[model samples]
Target: MMADDGGCGRCCFSFVLTSGLSALFLWLSLRTYKPSLFIQDLYVPGLNSRNNHTIFFQLTLRNQMKDKGVGYANISLSFLYNSTLLVANHTLPAFYQGHAKTAHRKDSVNAAALPWPPSNGTVSFRVRAATRVRSKIMLWFTKSHALVVAADVEVGASGEKVKKKSIKLKSGVADPGSRWLRMGVANAMLFAVFIF
Candidate 1:
């Protein structure tokens, strides 16, 4: 009977230990936030012409983590025509975004002075924004993240309606060096648990 009781106690202890470690790993995975950029709106203010024109738009930065915020190091915007012609470039001011919050900034790109004029009937161009960000969790841990947001739009002649298209650029999350460390720690813990 004593041997049976000892075996039961060990089983209970192992179950509780596994449960606790699993919970910790799950919480850590769910609590971290990934930064994202969005182009909310883009439109031309006046008629398209050979002369210079300004493109007006709103850009939104989002922080979805409930406990973490992001600090921007640099944000840049560029406009391209036919994927090769550079139309305009602008550097936006840096700003901080709070947890579960979003910030919007209004900016314009002047493309009128392009050396190559827009093709006569319809003109299509791409707008892209790239940003470098630092995310902080509880003021103790920080990681760097980078992302790009882009969209394409085509404008018809003076009387034609503009059809805006989805952004075709593909980007991935920028995981900081600490992210690898965290992953390694998690993997080690998992291996140790399973081995023992």
Candidate 2:
């Protein structure tokens, strides 16, 4: 009878331990927050003509997690004319963002001197930004998520401030290729953890 009671206690303890770990992992997964990117402003600072001009822009990053922060490994921004011609490109400096904080960065790019002027009064281009970010939840778990955001922007050669519009890109919508790959890898890791 004593042996039976001991076995029952061990089984109960095992069940409780497994349930607690599962609950903890589920909570962490649900609470994890992803960072977002937004283009605050874009305009031409000074230009005698459209031939040779410099474009200045402001970018903002908002961290959604209240207790977690993100560390950036690399960030690359590129501007393309008509989705083919590369107009300007800039590599932003690496930085860290605190939880629930917004970081604003100002950057400029000199448009390449074209042999011929643009036919229209406004030039349209796409802005593409790729970033590698590492997110940490409290002090326990850390994960890496890759984010790529792109938007079509038009600027008037007349130096008019581009219409004030907030262009914000979220993770899964902007770059599905990398997001899917990451999801697969994460699932594999989780399977390995739980199985082994």
Candidate 3:
């Protein structure tokens, strides 16, 4: 019985030591890991100038971290109409926007999400995001004026600095009256067909 007791004690000691070593290794690995975030594709869709429509754009962000990340993501969008600055806030419905750290990616510390930008750049850098940033913008047609739209966004990680780039975009919506006229003609044709 005494020998058996001694053997069990040794086994327990080895188990505890192994557990401690494993924990230490994990801590070191996490500390040495550097998180990375970058932007993917960003562009605006085409629009007809004669159809009182809105211009829309999209952006993609990507997170290149092996482990999960815990941090905040702040994205800003600037819109321009014919070289005029439109919405300047980065937030929703404004020029300012931000997301909490709780919003992560794939159960990891990283987050690859999409947030809309206020404006797109014509020649500058595009909006930066994680591994996948898919954002959309809507520019309403208000007049029969020739306009140029541009947008840009800056992105950074927790320990990294923020970077900026302009996104060049060219789009125009058509006038509302023309759209109405076309719709009316289409409706008239349909009505005539139905009558016949």
What is the Å distance of residue 109 in model 1 from its true position? 2.6
Where model 2 places Cα greater than 4 Å from the true spot, the runs are: 1-26, 29-31, 45-48, 115-120, 170-196
lDDT of 2 by residue, 1-196 (tens): 9999999888976876686578656655645555778878877533326454677888888988888788887789987765578878898988888878999989888877653334345655677888788776666446666778887776665554356777774443444334555775687568557744
The local lDDT score (0 to 100) that residue 170 gets in candidate 2 is 40
User: Which structure among the candidates has the greatest lDDT?
Assistant: 2
Ranking by lDDT, best first?
2, 1, 3
Per-candidate TM equals 0.70, 0.69, 0.26
lDDT of each model, Cα atoms only? 0.66, 0.70, 0.32
Q: Which lDDT tens digits does candidate 3 get at residues 51-149?
A: 222223343222233343322223344433333334222322212112211222211111122232332322223322211121111222112222222
lDDT of 1 by residue, 74-161 (tens): 7888877645677778889988888789888888777646543344465666777787777766665465567676666565555122
Q: Choose 2 or 3, whichever is better by lDDT.
A: 2
Show pairs that collide, candidate 2. none
Cα TM-score of candidate 3: 0.26
* CA displacement after TM-score superposition, residue 111 of candidate 2 (Å): 2.2
Give the C-alpha lDDT of model 3. Answer: 0.32
Off by over 4 Å in 1: 1-23, 26-31, 45-47, 115-120, 156-190
